[model samples]
Target: MAVTTAPDRAATPVRAPAHRVRRRPTAWIFAGPAAALFALFFAYPLGASLLQSFTAEDAGSTRWVGLDQYRRMIDDPVFLKSLVNTGAILIVQVPVMIGLALVLAVLLNQSWLRFRGTWRALYFLPAVTTLVAYAVVFQVLLKTDGGLVNQMLGGVGIGEIDWLNSPTWARISLILSLTWRWTGYNTVILLAGLQAIGKEQYEAAAIDGAGTLSTYARVILPQLRPIVLFCVITSTIGTLQLFDENYVLTKGGPDDATLTPVLYLYRIGFQQFDFGYAAAIAWVVVLLIAAVSALQYLAFGRERRR
Candidate 1:
C-alpha cells in the first residue's frame, strides 16, 4: 500500500501546534488599558495629593513647607473639635447601634419569627434609600419650627426643642439618624452569622443545662466573634469617615459639633481653598483609620487556637 512509504519523521515539515500561542501578550493586551487607567486616575492622584500635602501656596506660588501643614492640625480648634465629635460618635453611636443590632439579630433568628423576610427587608430599606431623599426627609423632620419630630414632642407635652439647631441636640440627632439608618444593616449581617450556626449547637447547649440567654452568651456569641469584629471594625471606620449624614443634616453643625474629619477636609479643601492642609488632614484620617482598624482587629479577633 502507498501508506507503507510514509514520509520520514524528521523530513515531515513540523507544523506548530495552533493552541501553543504566546499568552503573555494576550494578557497584557487585556490588562494594559486597565493598568493605564489606574495609573492615570488612582496612582497619579494619590502621589499628587501626597506631594501637595508637603507644600504650601505662597504669593500664588507653591513652595515646599515640610510638615507645616500637619503641624497646623495640632493647634487648629475646628480640626480638634472635629476629632472630638468623631471620637464621641465612635464611642457612643457605634456601641449603641451594635448592641441594638445584636439584639435584633437574635430576635430575628428565632424559629417562631413570622414573615422573617418581610421584616428583614423592611429593616434594611433605610440602608438602600436614596441619600438625597433621606437627607431631605430628615431635614424636614428635624426642622426647628413645626417639624414632625417637634410636633410629636409637643403632643406629648414635651416642649418644642430644636432638634437640629442646638449643638447638643444636633449631635444627638446625628447619632439617632445614624443608628436608625445603620442598625438594621448591622442586624442583617449579625443575623446571617446567627443563621449560619446550626440548631444542633443550640441543642447541644440545651443538653448541657444551659438557658437560652446563657446558651447565646456562652456558646453562640463566642463563635460569632468574627462577625461582631467585622461589624465593629466597619462601624468604627464609618464613624471615622463620617461626612454625608452630618453634612446634609447639619452642614457640620451649629458649632462644628458633628464636624467629622472628612467634612473638615471638604471645608478645608473646597470652602477655604486650603488644599495642602486638607490633604494633610486626609492623610491623617487615613492613618487613623488604619491604626484604629488594626487595634480593633487585635482586640476582638482573639480566638483559642484549635
Candidate 2:
C-alpha cells in the first residue's frame, strides 16, 4: 500500500518567472523622472566642470585651452595659500568636530538621560538653522566692539579680541563656526548608530562584570566603526571644500588666512570670471577628496580587521 511506481511519481510544476508576476516596465516608468533629474543636475554639472577645466575664454568668451589653466594653478600663490588653509581645516577641525559629535551622541543616547527629546532638539537646532542666518548672526556676535562675545569676555576681565580681524584668530573663528554648525548633525548620526546596537549584547556585557567604560570601549565602539568612518570621511570632504562660512563671515579676509579652496574657486570663476582656472581648482578639489576618502577607507578597514 505504501510503495508507488516510479512512473506514477511526478515532478513539481514549474513556477512562473519572477518578472511575469511583477511588471518591471512600470517600476522604470516611476524611476525615469528621478534618473533624468540626477543626470541633468548632478552628472551634467560634474562632466561640464571637468570639460570646462580645459576650456579657455577670450574676454568672457570660452574656448578650449588644453591643460593651460591647470598649469597656471601650479604656480598661483593664492591657490597655494588656499590649499594650506583647506589642509589645515581638514587636519584640525575634522577630528575635533567628529570627536565632539561622538561624545555628544553617547551622552544623548544614554538610557538614563532625562528629557532626551528636548535635548536632542536643542542640539539639532543648529543643524536645521539656515546657514545664511547663522553666518550673519555669528558675524554680529563676533564683532570686536560691543559684540556679545567681547561683552562676555569683558565680564571675565579679558580684553576684547579681534576675532575676525586677526589672521590666526579668524581661522580659529571659522573652525569654531564650522564645528558648531556640523557637530549636531554628526551627533544625530552616531546616536542612531548607538540606538541600533543590540540591547541584549550591552546587558550581557554588564552581567559579565563589564563596567560602563569597558562596555563602551569593547562592545559599543567596535559596533560603531562603520558609522564613525562615514562621519570622518564626510566631515573631511566637507571641511576640505569649506566655503559658505568663510565667504559670508570673513569673505576669505584677514590677509587670506581663512580662504578655503572653494572660496578661492568662487573668486576665480565668478568674481574674476576665470572659468578655466576655477574648473581646474574644482578638479584638484575632487582629486584631493578622492585621495583622502581612499586613505580613510584603508585606515578604517585595517582598524576594523584588527
Candidate 3:
C-alpha cells in the first residue's frame, strides 16, 4: 500500500510556506520608494560631482583636465587661508565644546536638579532656532553701538568690547555663536550616554570607597569614551565645513579671519563660476573628513583593545 502511494509522488505539487511567500515581497514593497529616491537624489548627485571634478567646463567647451584643478588648489592663496582658518577653529572649538558639553551633561543628569526639563529646553533652544534669525540677533546684540551686550557691560562699569570688528574678536564671536548653538546638542547626546550607564557600576564603585572624582574618572569616563569620540569626530567635520555662521555673521570678514573650507568652496563655485575647481575642493574636503574619521575610529579601536 505504501509503495502504491509513492507512485503518485512525481505528480504532487510542493507549496511554499505561507510566511515565506508573504515576506518575499514585503521588503521590496516597503523599501522600494525610499531606495528609488535615494538613487535619484544622493547617488546621482554624488556621481555627477565626481565626474565633474575631472572635467573643466567653460561656457561653450568642456575638457578633461585630470588633476589640474587639484594642482591649482594647492597654490590658491584663498584656499590655503581657508584651510588655516578652518584648522584653527577645529583645534580650538571642538575641545572647548566637548568639555563644556560633558560638564553640562553631568550636571543635568543629577536627579535632584531643579527645573531640569526647563533647563534642558532652554539650552536646546538655540539648536532649533533658525540660523539666520539667531545670527541676526547675535549681530544686533554684538553691534558696536547700543547693543545689549555692550549696554550690560557699560552698566557693570566695564568697557564695551568690540565683538566683530577686530580679527581676534571676530573669531571669538564666531566661536561663541557656534558654541551657543551646538553645545546643547552635544550635551543632549552626552546626557543620553550618561543615562545608559548602569547604576550598579556606580554602586560598586562606591562600595570600593571611590570618591566622587574617583568614581567619575574610573567608572564613568571610561564608559563615556565612545560617545566622546563620536562627538569629537562630528564636531571636527562640522567645523571643517563651517559656512553659515561665518557667512551670515562675519562674511569671512576682518581680513578673512573666519573663512572656512565650505565658504571657500561656495565662492569658487557660485562666485567664480569655476564648477570643476569647486568640485575638486569639495572632494578634498570629503577626503580630509574621511581620513580624520578613520583616524579617530582607529584610535578608539586601539584604546578598546588595550
Candidate 4:
C-alpha cells in the first residue's frame, strides 16, 4: 500500500510567501491619469449631455421635461428639413464617393502606375486641408460674379450660377465640396485594403480567362466589401455630422437648404440659448449614428455570409 503523507506543520512555522501585489500595477499606474482625464473630459460630458437632453431651461434654471424635447423634434419643420437634407446627402453622396474611391483604389494598385505615393498624397491632401479655409476657398471659387467657377463657365459660354444662394445649388455645392475633400481619403483606405490581397488572386482570375472588369466585379470587389462598408459607414456619419463646410460656405444657406443636424444643434444651443433642445438634437443624432452603423454592420455580415 502506498502511503500518502502531508508535511507536518508542528515541526516549524510555515512562512507564507509575502503576498506582494503583482508588478503589473505599473501599467495601471501609467494608465490612471489617462483614465482620469477621459472620465473628466469625454465620459463626464457625454453623461452630462444625455442628462441635459432630458431637461429644459427657463429663467436660467434647468427643469426636467423627460421626452418632451424629443417629441418636439417630430413637429419641428426645420429639424425635419435638416434630417431630409442629411438623408439626401447620405443617399446621393456616399455611394458616388465610394464608387469613385474604388476606381481610384484599383488604379492606384496597378503595377503600371508611376509615382503612386505622389498620387496618393495629392488625393489625400484635400482631406487634411484646413477645413474652414478650404470652405472659404470654395466660397470664393463659387461666387456668382467674378468667381473662378463663373469665369470658367463664361469662357465656355455658360451663365453664372448662384451656387450658394439657391437651395438646390447650395446642396449640390456642399455635396461637391464633400466629395472633393473625402474621395481621396477613401481611395487611400481602399487602396490599402486592395494591397492586402495577394497578387495570386489576380493571376488566377486572369488565368481563368476573366476580363479585368469581370474579375473585379465578380471577385476582387467582393473581397473588398468590408473596407467598402467601413468607408460607407464613415461617410454616412460624416454626412450626418456635416457642419463646417456648409457653415462656412453658406451658414446653413440662403433658405436653410444646407442645414445639418449639427448646425441645427449649434443654432439651438448657442444662437437660441435652448441648450436642452440642442442636447436632445445631439442625442438624437447619436442614436441615429448608432442605429445606422448597426444596420450597415448587420447587412455587411449577412452579405459576407453569402
Candidate 5:
C-alpha cells in the first residue's frame, strides 16, 4: 500500500537478447552435425567425381583431359549399346509397371475387399526380398533346360524359350524381373496417393451418376497426376542406373544386350580400372536423368496450368 508496485515498475529488466543468444547456439548445435555429414559424404564425393571426370590417369600420372572421355563415350559402341538397352527398359518397363501398379492400387483401395492387408503384404513381399536372392531364384527358374518356367511352357505346347542366352530373351528376362520386383513398390506409393484423395469427391461423382471408369478418369487420375509423375521419374532414373539384376542374373551377357549404364560404368571403373572414364559416364547419366526429370516436370506443369 506504500506505493510498492509503482516503485518496481521502472526497474523491470529485458531478457530477450540473452534468450536469443541462447537459442542461436542451440539451433546450430542441432543442425551442425547433419550439415557436416552432408558435406563430408555427399558433397565431397560428388565434387571429387566431377573433378575426376575432367582428368585422366595414365601410367601412374594424372593429367587434365577436359572432354576427351566424353568424346570417347560417344564413339564407344558398348556405351551406345548400354545406353540403348537402358532406354529400352525405361520406355517399356516403366509404363507397364506404372499401369499394373495403378490397377493393383485401385483394386486394393476398395474398402469392401477381403483380406486387404494380407493381399498388400503378399504383393509387397518381393520389394523387400534380398536382391541377390531374387536374382538367383529367377536365374534358376528361367534356366533354358529343365527349369520350372520352361517345364510349364512345355506342358502348354510352347517350345522351350532361352531366357538367359539370347539377347531378346535376356532383355525380356530383365524386364520381367524388374517388373516383378518394383511393381508392388510403386503400387504402395500409388495406394498412398489414392488414400490421400478425399472420399467426398467419390461421393460427388456417384451422385452425378458417374461410373467407376468415369470417376477415375475425371477425378482420381487428375488428382494422382503428381504422384504418377514422381513414380515415372524415379522409375526412369532407376532403369537408367540398372545394374544389380544385370550383374546377378545375366551378367550383362548375350553380347551385352542387357548391359546398363551403371554396369558399363562398373566395368570401366573396376574391371578395366578406368576411373576417369567411369566418372565421365556417371556424369553423363546424371545429365540424362536430369533432362528427363525436367521434361516430365515441365509437361506436368503445363497440364496443371491448362
Candidate 6:
C-alpha cells in the first residue's frame, strides 16, 4: 500500500509558479490590440454598411425602409449595365493579365537570363507608380486626336481611334491600362511561387527527356495552384469594384458603357447625396464579390485537398 501510494503521488502534476506555467494571460496581452483594431476598422464598418443599406432618405433624414432599396436595385437598368461591364472585365482582362504574368515570371526565373534584375525592375515599375499618374499618362498617350498612340498607329497606316469617346474603345482602353498596371505585380508574386518550387524536380524532368514547356506544364503549374487561386480571387474582387480609372478617365462616359458598380455607388452617395441607394448598391456589390470569391475557394480548395 505504501509503495502504491508513493507511485500515485509522483504521477500527479504539481502546480508551478504563474510566471512559469501560465500562458493564457500572455497570449491575450499579445492578441488584444489586433482584436480591437479589427473590431473598429472591419467589423464596425461592415455592420454599419449592412444597416445603412436597409434605410431610406426622407427629407435628409434616414428612415428604415426594409427591402425597398434592394428591390429598386433589382430594377435599375444603369446598375445592370455596370454589372455587365464589370463582368466583362473579369471574363477578359484577368486571365490575360495572369497569363502574361506567368510567362514573364518563367522567363525571369531562368538562371541564364541576362540583365534579369533590370528587366524585373522595369516590369514592376508600373505597379508601384501612383494610380493617378498611370491614369493621367495613359489618358494622354491614348488621346484620339494627335495622341502618341494614334500617331504611332498612323505611321503604320492605321487611322486614329476615338479611344475614350467610343464605347468599345473606352472599355478596351481601360482593360489594357489595368493589365499593364497589374501584370507586373502578378509576375512578381508568381515568380516568388516559382522560386519556391524545387530545382530538383526540374532536373529530374530534364533527365526524363522533358523539354521546358512540358516540365512547366506538368510540374511547375501543379505546384503553382495555390498562388494562381489567390491571384484569381483577388483580381476578381478588384475588377468587380472597378471605379478609379473609370472615374478619372471616362467618368463612366460614352453612354455609360464603362460604368462599374462602385462608380454608380459613388455617383449616388457622394454626387447625388442619395446615401440610402448607394449603400444598397454597395451591399449588392459586396454580395456579388463574396459569392464569386466563395465559389473560387470552393473549387480550388477542393482540388487542393485532393
Please identify model 2 stretches exceeding 4 Å from their true place.
Answer: 1-28
Q: In candidate 3, what are the lDDT values of residues 1-306, reduced to their tens digit?
A: 455444676688889999999997998999999999999999999999998899998776989999898999889998899898888888888999999999999999998999999998888888899888888889999987999999999999999888888888988898899899899999999999999998899999999999989999989999999999999999988888888899988899888888888998998899988899999999999999999889989999899899
- In order, what lDDT does every prediction score? 0.91, 0.91, 0.91, 0.93, 0.94, 0.92
Candidate 5 Cα outliers beyond 4 Å, as residue runs: 1-16
Instruction: Supply the TM-score for candidate 4.
Output: 0.93
Task: Name the lDDT of candidate 3.
Answer: 0.91
> What's the true lDDT of residue 217 in model 4?
92
lDDT of 6 by residue, 191-268 (tens): 999999999999999999999889999888989999998888988988998888888889998899899999999999
Poorly placed runs, candidate 6 (over 4 Å): 1-4, 7-17, 20-36, 302-306
> Is 2 or 6 the stronger prediction by TM-score?
6
Residue pairs with backbone overlap in model 2: 56-63
lDDT for predicted candidate 6 compared with the true structure = 0.92
Clashes of each: 0, 1, 0, 0, 0, 0
In the range 1-306, model 4's lDDT, one tens digit per residue, is 999999787998866555544544777899999999999999999999999999999898889999999999999999999999899988999999999998999999899999998999999999999889899999999999889999999999999999999999999999899999999999999999999999999899999999999999998989899999999999988888999999999999778889999999999999999999999999999999999999999999999898
What lDDT score goes with residue 116 in model 5? 98
Q: Which candidate is the best by lDDT?
A: 5
Give per-model TM-scores. Answer: 0.90, 0.89, 0.90, 0.93, 0.92, 0.91
Judged by lDDT against the true structure, how good is candidate 1?
0.91
Tens-digit lDDT track for model 2 on 196-256? 9989998899899999999999999999999999999999988888888998899998999
Candidate 3 minimal-lDDT segment of 10 residues: 1-10
Tens-digit lDDT string for candidate 1 (84-178): 99998889999999999999999888879999999899988998986667877888998889799999998999999888889899999988988
Model 2, position 161, has a per-residue lDDT of: 95
